[model samples]
Target: MSGYVRPGNSQPALLFPFIAGVVVVLSVLPLVRLAMTGLSALAAGGAISVLADRALWAAAYYTLVTALWGTLISVAIGAFFAFVLTLTDIPGKGPLGFLFVLPMMIPPQVTALAWVQMSGPSSPLLKALGMAPPLGSPQPLYSAGGIALLYGVQHAPLVYLALRAGLMSVPRDGVEAALLSGASPFRTFRDIVLPLALPGMIAGAAIAFVSCIGNFGIPAILGIPASIYTLSTLIFTKFSAFTDRTFGEVALLSGIIALISVVGLAVQERALGRRDYRIAGQAGARATFSIGGWKFIFLPLLAVLLFFMLVAPFLALLAGSLVPAYGVPLTFQTLSFHAFEEVLLRQTITRTAFANSLFLATVTALGLLALSVLAGYVLSRRRDAAASLVASLIEIPYALPGIVVAVAFILVFAAPLPVFNVTLYGTIWIILIAYFASFFAVSLKPVVSAYRQLDPALEEAARLAGAGFFTRLKDILVPLIAPAAGASVILVFLIACNELTVSALLWSTGTQTLGVVIYNLDDSGSSDVASALSVLVVMMVVIMMLLLEGMAKHLPAGVVPWRS
Candidate 1:
């Protein structure tokens, strides 16, 4: 409200156009291109052939079923945790929440890989424990339920975060009033807490469902061998078997995915419609329930859950990495670091993947931050229709699935540029560009939030002292928002490093990312080496998260997600 731009302002004239141009290129153009292509395909009657295919229908069915089941599972688990952790006197809530969200941060393929190694007849850990299933028994994970289970595990954090946010606003006075009136805990929760949290739960479920639909790693690992295919995997396969009609066909498929995602969002909106969830009194979350004697039961229950969710599978991955071969039992005599040595020293592909992912993440994080600082100034300074439109445009790419964005880029850049005369397809630069587009919103949010919280008078005084825009930005703006900028960089880096969906489609021979390399290794029957690389990737993710966690106190409140 305060950082208004006067008429004939040179800064707005320069900044607004540049920011709009970047958004058009990064978000608008690609999505429009995709939409046009899909419509053209449909107009040409290509949809009949594409949509009538039994395989396509099967994949659609699988996509919906798995996503639905997965959403329910995610909601159940996420809601339970959110309610207990937010409303009760749970000890070690910080650490428990951190551990619970770790699976979401880790790559999906790594999660599948770890779970695969934790069970089945081929499991090295289980084999070592002499509890291996009979040889030739089909692994259970290669099924619809297995995929949904893993989907639940992977996306549960989304629900937890969403619902926790809503629960945090539950008025303490209402709960206290209900309790004083002799309402039992169950009745009070059902009447007061449930209504307020419903919207968040629905929103979380919608997000989880969309995520499951877009997921490539889990189904690709667990479903492909069993001939099960989700829409994402189906699209990947259609691309794999490329033909003259491949572009049109894939466009149709991507449109289906986009349509489904939009529908999920719409359902969430409808469910939350006509409901005023506003609280009148003081609104800060605090423990409303004292589980005095229930602590003993709850503590072990949570510990066991965390053990299965984080500890056990990670240990299995460790065991798998140390084993000399995939199926070999991990014993004191048999244990070796051969997989680690091979992955780190012998494999050029692994090294390239590590380098490429790190480089891409670092560049994307820093690059987006620079742009975000400029864009954030424009956004926070103006409260006009254009600013709101630009903000929505920025969110489109981030909200849509990564694979859809990747497809859009492929369509846009597969041909050589008009002036530059260079093709970005099949190169690292394409991946980099895609990363920028996909993560621009992520890098901008913190900067914008920080900017909104700033005192405009500080900048006004500096401007009145004849300080130029960039000078004010560098000297005042950047310093004040440094903590948030740091948080943005770390968040984007953490996501980009473990990214599989976008890179899986955009990667070339020499530009394999960590996610791609890990998937390929597992696909190519080098499970041990894949496990080794996954272990390293997981360690990197944890280290980055810890760095953010350590800096949480200095950063803005919501900047460090998974923190209460």
Candidate 2:
């Protein structure tokens, strides 16, 4: 009697809540399983404590080091690019901007493969230029420095996107006032611009650090060879390596990592509390400054950064895919499309992986959109203790990395439970659960933000007119927030498509995705096939983005702004 009742609809409104409840249960099953596993392990003579020994400590140290370095380098390069693109009249700015940000679209494994091929002693550039010592062997590809370089290059574009938005949000009037007051450019940036943009920088840096720490493929491909390890790498090892099938240990380490991420999130929230530096105002014309004397210095520096970060790796992927083998000299005669053909035709692996990736991504996107919209509505409209608690609990996954979530899923789903006889160990169901847990925050954030912007009076008016909750949601909120929801779905699909960490660990042989295929090929020393798969995955992502862009033009204006 207290629930929603639709007037015009044939079906009862009770069905909606029932469906929603079922979806929530299905979505949260993996997390429940993980908790059970961890608890079970904890009871078994300190299984959790034994796993967090010296090896894990070392991994934590290295993870912190690389994440810090990567975040620092990413911030520097991203700030420079953001400044150049927004404030300077650089030549080919549009094309350069696209090129700079494109790396972020490609999966990290592809970038790692490209660097591995290029840094080889027999690389065309090194060999032709005689840069490699004749007696020296090929340089190792998996050193800590190499991992840092890949991390920096891979995440630079993420920083760029964040800072670019922040740069555009700076009030032109403030800058004009500073300049008119005889403040030099450097002084103005130091005094006014940076302080205003500090939140964006911190947000970008925190994202980069979290992402870098949670990354599995880059370190797996580049760091594993050198015996360098991170928490993500260790998680993968415990899950996959035949020698290390200690589920209890894996669960403990994963829980610890999740706890660390949670702590970081709390700290960030506390640090940003009551800080009102967020940009707010009507739109104005973008301000540009002349880079008269420093164009020479600034342009070349940006070019070099872009080259190493974007161009070099992609080109390496292309070249490696064409060449028959890794560390081999490239020539017109030696180049062939054999790798591509093999990946597409001869090997069923790539095709199957692509199909699986597409399926999982689609389902995850749809599921995330539906759940997020409902949750956002409840949180925004109700504002009660229960709703607030649920909202906060929903965010737990965001702090935890994909690798940890995957491990947690494995820990929970592999054990015997009361209701389900067969565990969800090797099913596509586990992958879907992991995807939701890892990316649900992304879908929820935009919807929640958009919901907050809406005036409560509109909804109150609708309710006063006898508009039921479902009717108001369907006729009012849905249309207004369609764009936000659409954008959220697309972005979630993108992340799920390129997701390697969680998928790599949770996927069974039958559930292989493009990310898994590429990683497997790379691990098996089939660099050419891996490169080809990487290129194909990138193309698929581009196609998906194009489709989303087309769909976006039809959406409301406010929704489009939140796409990035």
Candidate 3:
């Protein structure tokens, strides 16, 4: 165990302290400071004053309402795809699955922008298609229901991924036995598959609900326009108008968001409690379904959904970028490259945003990978209480909403350091640190999973042969787990590049990320520039996904999301 363990098991197990130190600096310190501040304010009647504001409770209520509606919609749509593709004979399952999930890869704000351009009286796409609504009609997507709809669309793939795993575990022998016992297809599904899949569906709902509640980009783009707010957005607004009371107020809101997230996880935990979910041995097989005439119905319905989910909004986004202004009808003659040129060349902020986002994203991904590789290797070999505590600490930051994490980092770094006398507030380093805290789990999970699948005997042999720890890592562990490390890097990079919630609050003038720039451009009525930037973002996401898809052949199964 010591031989295969990271940094060995001596008192000087440097790996443990290194990991613990990281968790302390990145996760523990920030959250503790925020909690301490909030607690101090609560002792001073800050909670009462903050809670007295009608907007805060209204935002909380709106947050719950939208999250509930969004979860239901996601389950309805995502479970359909998950079940049909996994359990039925759906045609083009690969392409359908890929298309169904593309919306999730696109950022939430981009999703909102695309849908806005696809709907409403001001839609360039709608006008070009001669389907624009009449004058003076409101932008339908600016309503609470519209926000819920887009949230559902954006988070459905999360539900799909969660449920697909359960669907895959449905035992074929049981279905065959039921059929032999003269059970109808409906009866077999009702008795066997649905019961077995209930836990997964419930868990998926919980995941979607948490995501919707934490989502800042969607509501910031859609809800704020209608003067609506969720707890996440309310926190942002409170921070935007920073004041002496701002820290306490935002900390109060962040506590509410954290509570909401905790409730969600608790519900999932309760739903999943103590149940042995393993299917019988020899259960892995294709879903046993034969609905010959139902093919037409299933395939076409899925195709239409794919079109709406992936094709339509992207085209609308493209059209929005092409038009000279928001409501102008897009035509071959009307379309021009001015928006693209201005964004890609002329705007200094655009250039800064690109460079900053790329730098932050790359650094976060690579840095976390280095840390996760060591931590994952160590934790995989050691399952003591200390390791579990460290693991739990690492998860706390990622489990909280990005907004809460941002607020925590704000509290942690708001003041100048004790001896250094240098403050990190309003700096790019702050955002980078926040990204590390926010995305640490995303980077750690894949590598840990890969470590679990590896055998320890080879490393033990290396130790018996007197090879150093670094030598074994270089000659043994790194070569074997490289693909998982790559996957971890890509996942973190994808998420960090598309991040808006944390940066929304933490960003200063020169430190804007892609998400901040997109939101700001739209907020300032530069719809053309926003749309152009969004189009570029969408392209980048797709390209990176394709890159991951290409690398999937060399990787273990389930690393690349789109790959079957």
RMSD of 3: 2.1
Candidate 1's residue-wise lDDT over 444-518, tens digit each?
998998999999989888878978788898899999999999999999999998999998889989999999999
lDDT of 1 at 2: 28
Top candidate on lDDT is: 1
What digit string (tens of lDDT, one per residue) describes model 3 on residues 144-209? 899899889999998898888777778888888889999999999998888888888888899899
Rank order (by TM-score, best first) = 1, 3, 2
Give TM-scores for every candidate, taking all chains together and pairing residue i with residue i: 0.98, 0.86, 0.97
Query: Please, what is the whole-model Cα lDDT of each candidate in the order they appear?
Result: 0.91, 0.74, 0.88
Pick by TM-score: 1 or 3, better one:
1
> Which pairs in model 2 have colliding backbones?
33-412, 34-412
Q: Runs in model 2 with CA error above 4 Å?
A: 5-43, 47-53, 87-95, 124-136, 241-245, 270-288, 292-297, 449-477, 548-564
lDDT of 2 by residue, 1-564 (tens): 344445544224555455346435544555666666667778975574655588788888888788778878888877778778876777767667766767776788877877776776755444434564453674666677777777777787777777767777787777778899999988888888778767667677777777788877888888887778898898787666654337767777777676666665565566667468755443544556767878888888878987877677667777778888775656777777899999889998888888888899999999889888887776665556755656655666666688877776776676655676877788888898888877877788878877887887787788779787778889888888887788888878987988888888888878998888898998998888888888777777767666666666655343433233
Candidate 2 residue 266 Cα shift, in angstroms, is: 4.2
Per-candidate Cα RMSD to the true structure, in Å, reads 2.1, 4.0, 2.1
